[model samples]
Target: MRGTLLFDGRCGFCTRSRDLLARVDRHHRVETVPYQHPGTPDRYGLTEQQLARAVWWIDEAGTPRASAAEAANYALSAALGTTLPLRFYRLPGIRWLQEALYRWVSNNRQRLPGTTPWCEREPGTCG
Candidate 1:
């Protein structure tokens, strides 16, 4: 399946992570684009600030998903050429916890890799 990755290009950390992913992703199933690219916000139905806050993924079929932690898992599974985890993401109980955990990380991702000062504006609010 083909997918597009929307990311923050201005942030050094974000650029490095995307570069790493590009290096590991040999099949090129995933394509990266800066969230601030022209028409990106309109295309993704997100504000520039929101795009900066997390990663966005759009499947070839047009389904869009966004969240930092989940994006990590998605990229890992895709690079590894496995769909087992993706399948797991569909389970009810696990799905809830996964989303909750992802939300927690997304809310605090400034403390993780590739984060910027803009990510720490408020506990749950993006700058």
Candidate 2:
């Protein structure tokens, strides 16, 4: 259940999110890495555009979860050690809802908590 969580390093919001994850992840099942870290994205076969679009998770077996919600679910599952909430994300109608919510938050991330002025001026140019 170990994995790497890739996020934007220069993004204040993303950095704060990573910190929160680190605090909650008492089991240490996940390791957070900034996409700008040398060779990090390349190791996971991730493109700049993909990194810009959403957070990503690469499992120990090299399986990737690109959707932000799905990645979050994986992280939370590892932290909480329960798959019940994750099951809801896979339900027929709920899946789309979860994605939509994630998208909405992602799209407005610059305006959300922990965002810096640089994040506001540039959407995803963090490096």
The candidate maximizing TM-score is 2
TM-score of each: 0.65, 0.83
Residue-pair clashes per prediction, in order, are 0, 0
State the TM-score for model 2: 0.83
List residue ranges in candidate 2 displaced over 4 A: 115-127
- lDDT for model 1, please: 0.68
lDDT minimum window of 10 residues, candidate 2: 117-126
Local distance difference test values of all predictions, in order: 0.68, 0.76
Lowest lDDT block of 10, candidate 1: 118-127
Q: What RMSD does each model have against the real structure? A: 6.6, 4.4
Residue-level lDDT tens digits of model 1 in 1-127: 5677877665556666777888878888788777766788887777777776788777776566745656655765676578766777767787788878767755665566763422232223222
